[model samples]
Target: MTAAVLSVEKFTVSMPDATASTPALGLGQDIDNCVPFMTVSSDNEANEAQMVDVKKNGGTNKFDFTATALGARDLEVTVVEFDPAQVTIEEVSFTLGSGLTANVTVGTIVEANTFPIVYAHSAGDTTDGYDHVMMRATFTSTTNLQIIKQVHQADLVGHAYILEALNGQWSIETGASIPLAYTTAQTTKNAAITVTANRTGLWSYWDTSDIGDDPRDSIWDGVITDATNLDLTRANGSTPSADGDIESFVVNFAADVAVVQQGEFNYVTAATKTAAISAPGTLGNTMVVATNAYGWCESTGVTVARATCQGRMTFNSAIEVLGTRSGFGNGEYRQNFQVIEWLIGGAAAAAEPIIIMLGY
Candidate 1:
């Protein structure tokens, strides 16, 4: 007698949510959470000795059985969950035709591939049944495997079925044995400008250093420079005091990012001040009032440097006039304004600081 070789595919025997009634092997089936039994049969007399068993390997389960038959004949596999108290049962069956006559090839070799992630069929939280049961098994050749996840359970209906993958950072399944993986990465760079002034001075409006008769009033052109004996006064007609505190004003700033998106908090609230940003600069244009607002929300808790990086706020106007004319998504884009002015309720408040943020 010629023996047939067979290696069943991997599958998970999903247990329903119910009480275990029948004792040994849980195969007695008391209804609800009863164990399932499987049987293998074929037309050929040589196939009568075939034994089918489901084995648990880690998170996966496999069906094991004889692969080769004496001459050639069709084989039938049946699985059923029974309730010992009742005769009715939920059963399913499949037919595997003779290896010599069918296109499928049977083998005795142990063929199995493990996935990077472990898949769990049941949540095990409630006695409630599942929407469906998904199983992966190889019934054809050793190399060809088929996954079944859409099988509907008799008790579970209307609800959706899910296969939870717990192992990798990210999982992408295409109904295949192996799934794709994904990870996240990030980088940062500083863009704050620093400088010192030779004399105490007041900051004039954005573009021009001297807007009024007071040449002593000056605003840095959003440029960074360093030197000794720096004068940092910003109120017009203010005496040139040796206040080194003024020089320390524009020193610290956060690193600039390639992109900024809306954060979780809203821009404007009763307790917080709103901030604004402008587009980057182009060849002929500077950040001006006409620049677009690319942000979806307003700025809150904005500081002087952050508000400055965003753009200049008018004396009392709610809008922030960005210094750059260029827009976001440009080949190389950045915040347009290098310098900023602070004001409260339409009046300049050189003393009060603001907070700014660039969301990820």
Candidate 2:
């Protein structure tokens, strides 16, 4: 019968061994917190395959045979093959198209350079071989043999130096910072004619003398032979013993900066110091006076009264105030009021009928 000319496609079924059986393997379901995941790289790109949650307590759940036919696919299985091995989720291929395109910015690198000092001093100015850098400084001294010293460097904010001994034998050690030096009575020891801004500080101890000498009275002079950031207070912050211990303080880095607008103090409070008046003058209290009393509320612990506001402060008297104004930039203070424009009525006045503008 010619064996029926059969082309057989054999299907073999292997019976389980005589032992415990293996559980069925999960297909598309994921694993909890994923255990023993496999990572592989194809073209410098890596992917992972892990366990997935199937959400089945070994129940007859319908399995979806859908496959990820697109980008960056990862495969995971929840259940391991134990008994009744069945579904095999072999290889998972991905097509990561336009998924990870990023715009990276790369910055260019730069290098640096250096420079030199514009004002350096000289070295060695003594019989005792001590190298001293030199620079012209403005210094001031007093006749009180107890001469007050001041030091002003070209670079005020640069270095902190002091002048210990002024004129050899004068054993004086100056403070590092300059105490403010403004007074009703200017002092001989105040900022000198040749030396202003130069204050003194003996930030360090000197073994030898660099100071020149005193000509006659406790009166003396100094040769700003040195300039250094090393405690070189080359000027004096002292008020003449004559100026009283006027509680000298400094307009420190903390002190309010001079606010300049039309150049003035804003909340300026000036008074004629009437040995009998009270309330502050409103901005309109313009009763033309005789002189310009450019008075601002300045508390001079000690009373400093003007002889009289009669002649100096009248209808023609003028004043101005400047302080920080908004719509503007910096905190400023300037002389907005110059007593020069002061005018008492008399006849030809701008604010006719002598309208006086009081307390700027």
Candidate 3:
């Protein structure tokens, strides 16, 4: 023999029509529209009972129990996902009338209305030949309708809508079927990328000789091909043939580059070179350094100038200086170095002096 246990498969609600006559439940007309309740994460029920105890003067326990207050039952439902089209009339700003066909969009105002609710259960007791079971509650009111919005995480649970039922007057019906039709949940995929026109000459850079000269004379125009790659060519769209011309350039993205997936390797390489260059100067001055260039203090008693090496700068007063290096394909590379400050006893010098050295 099969077990008689059953699971709640569907839950629905029917709004009351003011023009129609009340049913046997003494609430409203039995339209039986039975719209399927939207997606729900959890459904919980609570019951409270009120009673009075009677006892004799010499008795050790209560002799009798009596009902003193009205009983209360509540049903709480929470939905993490739902179908907007099916529930637009019921949940959004709309009103339902006699049948499901009479729904009207009433702007933003939602009326406080009472309705009937039903909970349909799965097939139970095959030997007894019962198809399914359903519980119908009349004169049910919705309370504590809360809308919760939170940060999205791994669960993919977006907005949550909670509904509470008060004044539970209900009955169970055997061998019942769901009346209304419901739409299956649809899968929404990510949008496709659209590129209408190609963007060229997005960026340009000048060489050492062209620093104060005409930019068009030595400018290397950069063209972006896609989201990850860029091409550098002469302003005239020709490859470099002579020396001192922009040879090849490459960009190596770090492991944690923004918008790119982690652990994925991405890089762009251009040409070849024989030697790298480095020039040191004070702050606010552009200084180009080759990859892996190191700066250090050589001697004391000399005012050390603040030099912008690559894209980094040295400390104001320190025995050793370490900075970031550019010109490499890699972006924003850093090498850590210990800094030691010198403190001499005796009278202090008018200006702290230190020698700066650059090495490959």
Candidate 4:
């Protein structure tokens, strides 16, 4: 035998305050404060338009037909058991919108209240099915609140309204399950490096001066002679033979010597020259050398040299950066059911209607 699948296993009803400033009925509410009741069964009557056929006296065939206008729909609920101790008798005795009207007691009117109601269905014995099915409606005690006492149980009957299409009196929605979280992949880009400077200088010297004195003194004198020259070459003394004589000079500079070198050089003097140097264009006469001298140069007004590198940014997919997800359908539908009116009353016997209708 094939097993039958039950779409709805059970149902629940929630009641909300009708006296709220903006009373929203039949969407969802906190059921913790509501009185608990066991419902035996429930049913509904759509009460759609009724068609009337018109026939002509001259012919046996059918003629034109007209349909009666649609009216309010009905939903009946049969409750078998409820807790009477949870509510006070004085609170249930007064009927809503009836100026505290009282009803004739058959045994004892346990409870009564007027409010908007929401009906929800639970999926039973199905994995791939709707999550919830909710419907909105209202109950009034002036028309249909019935109570009957049996041997051990009392039956309470009430009616819900599905009024006009303008108010959206009755609506049912089925919600499907959807995903909540998503995963996204992204990519990083490569960085670039940059270098900057105010000026660059290169200096080269070929030492050719005598070892007894500082050869760098001639480079300093030459720098003083031409402070603005970018490429300056200067020698310390005249050319010497293969004897113990050292020659030194300096070359290129991007800026002025005083600006690059900052100041003059201070040196310690030697006791005597290692070898006496003949004066230029003199006959056998020797020139005396005393202290040692040195010079150094650097570029000026260079605040920064290099800059930090930056990388190009990329993404694996457009959706990753856009924050859009895939494989999930539309989410739940949550529209509150609108209620026009609410009524509350008590019934003497189960045979009589719980609600008494004064007029349509």
Candidate 5:
């Protein structure tokens, strides 16, 4: 069914009835004596379009009225008081209802609302100033009433912030804060929730969840951590329609884990110990008793092996080692020795697992 709501915007307009230093009631001096006609305008100059005065409620000193409203943004209201001889006026302040909310208030003046409806004002004197109870009407189409009502029901499902995982799974933390979810402020009619992660920009409607039905009906980001046991710091957003009102997002970074400890160490490998102990980084970096025992001493001495030599010796289990030890065989004792140390993920790839000893 086609339906709409009239958003009420009200303000009080008053001018000094009779001032001590002011002119007495002659032709058009005193307020009560003169026929005071008040009209709303959008500008302070009293030279533009006039406002439709909606005598909404039974408010005397106050000009109570409702204008079809739009999104919450900026609005200016001008109040014009006219008589044969105008009266000096000040600012115009307004109060909004329901979905209609205002930010700043300067006496009897403000910027345009979601829509611009300029009202003119005629001041008796520029220094004295002019005032009028002015506000614009902004008509906005709303979602279906059935769905809207269901949203505010006592049993209505609370808002949510989706914590998605890398695996395309998600977990829903309701009644909690969600980041980047709400593009608008929370209001009596609707509320917003944000879901944000550092480094990764905004994801799809897809989210990983472990609560309520699978949420399979809608698109979701995947792979979320278990509920009630994750980082559940939620942040609130402006009012967001549960319906399809997509808001853009900015790319921000969120930290998953901080560096706890960083360490570097040096060790020795097997093949080096037996061979003539070529160029090794440091002994004890990593020692192994391969075909021979006594890893440390027989341990490969200190030498920094190159990339190719490091790998072949570490994983190949055997490498040709030439030694001048005359104790076992002929003049030069050349034999196969296994690698004692592995250097992995070095400055570059192809490196074996290096000796990484942790420190306090």
Candidate 6:
């Protein structure tokens, strides 16, 4: 048994009024002012196309028509419906990145729901006196949209910007645009940072959450503190070229903990006095046994045990005779002996300073 099902498809067309013409086969026939008809075809021979009467739902628009019951074999539904005259255009205003504003409105019939189409506009006379700018409007929210002007510059052309829409919000995705002759822009600013010696050039951050898992899913520079924490900042200049897509991370010498404290001593691993030293108050009073505890040392860049170190240091045991706190060997010091870790014990004592003691 051939199962039968009914399907409906909607088409929007911008049709003009038909001209009055007589057919050769008919004699003295006045077939004038009749509505035009569209033929619907199907790929499967077994399934026949059904034509339905077009009705005007209280509107004078001629493009308003519906096709009903496009029949086909069970589970085999393939139909073709197209109208070339249905495209239209409207004007809209939007802002650009370089503090410029422009607009474009595209009117096209699409089979599926999508964001409103916008196009680039030519340079025009404005109060700012800007010219030859390519601009695009994107919906920032369901009710809000942005008009961004593309900036142009030398050697930084051909950078592609991808736009992705989600939940009615439009965002310009980040990534290296593929190579092309030149990039079109609406603003007159460099779109990318030029490469220089010992300096990294322009680059985009990859957002792994995009629809296609696109690496260059976002067009921003960001820092990742953890798996869930990401802070994105816009590029200072033009978007980077495709050559700058891959990631090259440089360990900041100032921020790198390892480099900053590479020469520091390990207080815990250093040998400590057999007995806990009492907190020190006076100088050269058989310095009280230091609380050789495992923790970070705040004394940074201090010369201890013939080594320079910075940042906190964890000690496996109490530091006794300056065995080694941060890469410093036993009995080495830049300052007087027993000055580092010299705890001034009192009821209202100040914060303990992570001091490195001079070796005897």
Instruction: Indicate whether candidate 2 or candidate 4 has the larger TM-score.
Output: 2
Can you write out model 4's per-residue Cα lDDT over 284-344, one digit (the tens) per residue?
Answer: 1101111011011111101111000000011112111001111111111000000001111
Assess the local accuracy of residue 115 in candidate 3 as a C-alpha lDDT between 0 and 100: 20
TM-score of 5: 0.13
| lDDT at 222, model 4 | 19
**Candidate that scores best on TM-score:** 6
| Tens digit per residue, CA lDDT, model 3, 1-360 | 111111111111111111111111111211121121221111111000100111111132111111112222111111111122111212221111112111222223111212211121111111111001101111111322111111111111111111111111111111111111111121111111221112111111111122111212222323334444433322132222211212111122111110111110011111111121122121111111211111111111111111111122233322222232222321211211211111111323223232222111
lDDT score at residue 1, model 1, on the 0-100 scale: 11
TM-score of structure candidate 3? 0.13
Per-residue CA lDDT of candidate 2, range 69-99, in tens?
A: 1112121111111111111112111111122
- Computed on alpha carbons, the lDDT of every model, listed in order, comes to 0.19, 0.17, 0.18, 0.16, 0.18, 0.21
RMSD of 1: 33.5
The sequence of per-residue lDDT tens digits that candidate 1 reaches over residues 1-360 is 111101111111211111101112212222222212221222222111111222222122222222222222111211122222221222122222222011222223222211111112122211111112212222234332222222222211111111111222112211222211111110111122222221111111111112122112212111122222212112222221111101111221111101111101121222122335432221111111111111111121111111111222111122333222111211111221121211011222222122111111
Sort the candidates on lDDT, descending order.
Answer: 6, 1, 5, 3, 2, 4
The candidate, 2 or 6, that scores higher on TM-score is 6
Q: Write the per-residue lDDT of candidate 6 for residues 1-360, one digit (tens) a residue.
A: 111111111121211111111112111211121111122222211101111122222133222222222321111011111111221112233323334433333333221112232222122221111121222334333334344433321111111112221221111112222111222221111233222111111111111111211112212232222222222322123232211111211111111001111112233323221222223332211111111111112221211221111111122223232322224332222111111121112223222322222111
Please identify model 6 stretches exceeding 4 Å from their true place.
Answer: 1-99, 102-113, 123-132, 150-360
The candidate 4 region of ten consecutive residues with least summed lDDT is: 305-314
Q: Which stretches of candidate 2 lie over 4 Å from their true place?
A: 1-243, 253-360
- Per-candidate TM-scores read 0.14, 0.14, 0.13, 0.13, 0.13, 0.17
* Residue 267 error, candidate 6, Å: 65
lDDT for 306 (candidate 5): 13
For model 5, how does the per-residue alpha-carbon lDDT over 1-360 read when each residue is reduced to its tens digit?
111101111112321111101112222222221111112112121111111222211122322232212111111111112121211122222332222222322222111111111112211211210011111121122110011110110111111111112221122233211222222221111223343321222211111111111111111111112111111111111122221221112112223210011111111222222233333232212222111110001111111111101111121222222211111211111122222221211223222322221111
